[model samples]
Target: MPAQPIHTNRLILIPFTLKITKTLMAGDIGILQKLGLQLTPYWPDQEAIDTFPKIIHNLEKVTEPTGFESYMVVHRNSMSVIGDAGFKGLPNDDGEVDIGYAIITQAQKNGYGLEVAKGLASWAFKQPSVKAITARCLLDNKPSARVLEKLGMQQVSTDVELIRWKMMNPAHEQDTIDC
Candidate 1:
């Protein structure tokens, strides 16, 4: 389960509960407000629009370890869906989890991406089992690379097709270094 709501400088990260995700998949955004989500109706990004069906399908068929769930990024002032961000799955045995996010084209470049990443990573770090958050982006996705970099995630590995970034929980890192 997620906390009340993960807040950032310009956005609110609302975890998508089963009811909310199901409602969203059913094409009714109005139900969200009544579900305790304090925001305007949702408007999924092109990516969210395209991938939500699969997301719903997977959520129904599988059980995630923990800390992996979709979150809606609502613009604080406008109370609107600026984009979405989430972990690919719960942290692994090594305490690493992959993350993914995207903003609607219109909302791009306004620092929302970094804000969402920061908010999500902060939330994940609150889970004692989560040690680090990781993300991968296509080499051409400079904006995403910038978001990860701005969130203090280092470029840990790269391949011809993508660059991988990771940021360990600061407290956990300090504990390790102090050992």
Candidate 2:
């Protein structure tokens, strides 16, 4: 079965399909209409546009969304496309998946970032294959760091340019103890 949309209290994360990515990259606004979503003036910004090619390329690898790729972040009340968020891909051999998100300038500082990250982590932990979720933010990106921290992710390491964070699945830890 194809991946289903993940609904949070105030947002619905719709997994990106090849068709949606292609339509967006084609500069077609009809996809929004079809999805029953509103357009935010600040969305489809340069950063979001640039990420489409990558989303498209990744989506092309599978016949359907695996719920491990990118998702369109839509506001529940306004139904507006506020941004994008999701796992980079399936869990690696270590059973860890990396998550990333971007909220439009208009939607920033409203607690949406934490909401999205929390929702993603919650969903990921429920998957048997996902033992941990990892994330990274630029060393200077305090806002992003705050979001990850708020989600209870620990700073696993840091480099000159980025700080890596990780959150292990609590259930997985429990299983280890029970084993």
Candidate 3:
């Protein structure tokens, strides 16, 4: 399947391509560490640089596949990889897509997450067949919920501690949320 592109006023959402340079890999590690995400169960911290070759090899397989395209959310002004944002898994006929994102810890609370999400989700809506975009956030994550709201997504349901927000028309919204 062909990957699609997403663009926003501040971001350029390109398709996921895994080419882990020594520098980028190192930056990934540092960014993860600063975000406190290294402690997350989904991905563990790399204890050594030697382990990156194997890690990158495995990442190559995970990154390049249908329904899973990651984008390095670069800041238009700074031109830095502040974080990663993407859609993972298959969205159903409901026009829903599972949105995922993680910004470097230092970048949080600066409104960058909401900024990138608006761009990415808007881009996703412009896809050939996309009708809506959905995102799940831990119920305790008020910031994420706010970001969803900023993108004009409304809460439709919940699972465990997760709250689901869906946006039906990102391309047409004038002002997304009260925030």
Q: Each candidate's TM vs. the true structure?
A: 0.82, 0.95, 0.64
Q: By the TM-score metric, which is better: model 2 or model 3?
A: 2
RMSD of each: 3.2, 1.5, 8.5
lDDT of each: 0.76, 0.91, 0.61
Candidate 1: tens digits of C-alpha lDDT, residues 66-123: 3476777778887777787787665789898888888887788888888888888888
lDDT of 3 by residue, 1-179 (tens): 54555666676554444443344455554554442322332221232233445434534655453434556555566555566667764456655677877666656788878877877676666665566788899999888888888878889999888998777755434334532
Report the CA-based lDDT of candidate 2 relative to the real structure.
0.91
Question: Of the candidates shown, which would achieve the greatest TM-score relative to the real structure?
Answer: 2
Instruction: Count backbone overlaps in model 3.
Output: 0
Report the C-alpha lDDT of model 2 over 1-179, residue by residue, as the tens digit: 78899999999999999988898899986789788988666778888899999898878888899999999999999999999999888899989999999999988999999999998998999899998999999999999999999999999999999999998899787766776
Model 2 vs. true fold: TM: 0.95
lDDT of 1 at 87: 77
Error of 2 at 65 (Å): 0.1
